[model samples]
Target: MNYIDNDPRLQTGKPAGIDKISIWIHPFLIREPSAFHPSSGNNKKVILRYTSRNGFSIDFQAEFFDPFKNIFIQILEYLIGLSIRGILKSPINKDFSTVEKCFCTLFTDLFAIDCIEFYFDFMRGHLILSNITNQKYKTTRYSNNYTREGKSVIIAYDRIERLKYVNQMNYDEISSIIYPMRFEFKLNRTNCEYLHPTNIFGNYNVIFDNYLIFLAKRWRMYNQQVVSIPVLNNLYYAEKFKTIIQYSQWQFPYSMMNLEKTPSCPMPNKSVKLKDIDRNWAVQFSLKDWV
Candidate 1:
């Protein structure tokens, strides 16, 4: 399988100006020397074939011998699970979510590691750049009162204040304060798997989930006008809450706005033609009726 070095700097953990490196994974079948032995047949093997832009190539194979067998098998499984087909088929410039899912699944499911935390750490620099760009866009796109960055910052600040007040601690001490709270909640779980933080990965999972819930709650609180009402109860708010629910997964969309135009007047009591009604109002009414 071919693996291009689109991000070679990631491998060295440093920014280097180099052309793309070509990578290939091939089966390194080895035939036994003994002809009479039952295990004389070719043994299964795998090797990584790396080729630089200058045509310099190197082949490396893992020692799948006794002591390293288990760890090497896990690593191989992870590499295989990151579908080679997807990588080849994907466009040169891929979306963040696609890359995130591929790497997260490769690390989390195959290696039993907390890839999301690693992902956050890996993207911290990019995120800082993104925030700066987004702030500039917000400044240019909207008025002071309607600036998304201002609103988001205020909401975040308020959440931090509430956390400090409720936990009786400073902002820096919030993690220590919330750890016990999270532990108590996890203890309530009936499943033995979650009863204790058996390993670092397990503990990280708990921390990550709790952190997501905390952020979700803060977001919901900030956008109470859109989230307080049921997703089914209002079409306007449902559309607005879709992105929020995607991030949080704490709310459900029981009903959705009807983008399709009604053929006839759905409401009998109201002597209003479907076409005559305002588009937003008509959609909302139709959605309620459909639900």
Candidate 2:
């Protein structure tokens, strides 16, 4: 959805906008070099064409083209339709935009969308990615994310905890504001919509819509969950109980928070299950913040 420049809420990083994008162009297929149209002195031609070989690929922070007068966009659509293969990346962290940086390729291998990763940073619900879904697919978990493979592939993982080591942290120091526990979704060629060269912008909207639907459907599946405790689980549990016991004279003791042994997964127990599994991050999410 190419929107007007005046629309503030639909800024880049928002649901309708993209964080990073990769485009692959087959110059051999683009024989119509005369398609480019010129404009005013400074804002003239849209593309800075360069030959491509061994290399295949190629936004704006918000809107690449001003909806009002966009010859540049028109030329892009035309060229893309002629020869294009692309990878479109979207970030769940709308607050931090990471636009792609593509330069002309002479010897580099073509850019491939091996998979698309949707990072739900600081949010969690491991069970959802455990295999539950509205659509059926082979589900498997290794390393961190849940993966579904077929016409397309999707990978979901924990962002904060995975990066804990970068900050010199073990799971012992997690935060609720950074919760419920964020996840990342990785999608392959078949699953990504932003690859359509002629309609990258339009496809971006579809990508965002599909994501919101996936989350909404999963959220509606159950009002609560009985969860397995990981080192991360203890943190979620600790925060959840604080709210539950707020009125009780006896507060939940910090010592009872299972903080022994420095084991990453917390104390080993076979039968411990926490119910009404708290998704603190999702609980506080508002679509308005995105759109």
Candidate 3:
């Protein structure tokens, strides 16, 4: 995946293209008093709040690779394969392009899927998706008026049965069924700097190089997990694992200095394993040091 030069034709905040997807870090994640904590379960509860002023929005024009889209497709296909093989019974007939469109609709109609708004549990080494809600509004300047709109829903990651049913339905039905739940959680009011980990400033090449290394490490760790898609209930196989590894490496090359060796993972199986990174080797060395 070579980086595409900025196109003047792209409107101010539109996605770069099919190849690019941006991840936004939530303001809460980097705040001085971070809402996230390793110990407290309540603190860890993920809540996505949308208001008229700032409905959930993630800017991806800066970073082009679409990890969310890639991972979503991988999981969707894996689920479909399971259904076809008799492990599960879900109707999945759509091609990659159709499924991709469905995913975009999910973001636009129901909830935002940008990296920033969601909580990334770094300590646990998995991404977490939780309940999402729309904020109610009240205005009292001229006259007392109150209005509440938008839907809320809790996506239970542990409930594979519910997800299976969802995968079987069309986009409209899925949206209608999943978009409404009560918004009950409290919002974090603390202010903080929004630093998307991948968007660190400096030389463009250096930042991209470091970002790729970070993504590779994270993806490898994610691939090694027993449950597929971590917080989401889906199963993955050897072939799909290979596809993920290849896709990540292809999108972000670890090194331009040397092309002799690249990141590699073992075949995906019941007992699949990830190779350890060698700090001493140029190929495995962290780009952070040089950057």
Give the whole-model CA lDDT for all candidates, comma-separated: 0.25, 0.30, 0.27
How do the residues 1-291 of candidate 3 rate in per-residue lDDT, one tens digit apiece? 221224343322121122222222222111122222233122111332333344322233223323323433433343334334433222244444533443333222212233321111111223233323212321001111112432111111222224334365455654443222111101111111122222332233333333434333345433332122352222121222233345455545444321122112212222212243222222322223111
lDDT per residue (tens digit) for residues 83-185 in model 1: 3323222213345454344433322211221111111111111111112223423211111223422222111112233455456456676543311110001
Q: Which stretches of candidate 3 lie over 4 Å from their true place?
A: 1-172, 175-210, 226-244, 247-291
Overlapping backbone residue pairs in candidate 1 total 0
lDDT of 3 at 171: 56
| Candidate 2 deviation (Cα RMSD) | 22.5
For candidate 1, the 10 contiguous residues with the lowest summed lDDT are 181-190
Which wins on TM-score, candidate 1 or candidate 2?
2
Decreasing lDDT order of the candidates: 2, 3, 1
Highest TM-score scorer: 2
Model 1 ranges with Cα > 4 A deviation: 1-204, 223-244, 247-291
Best by lDDT: 2
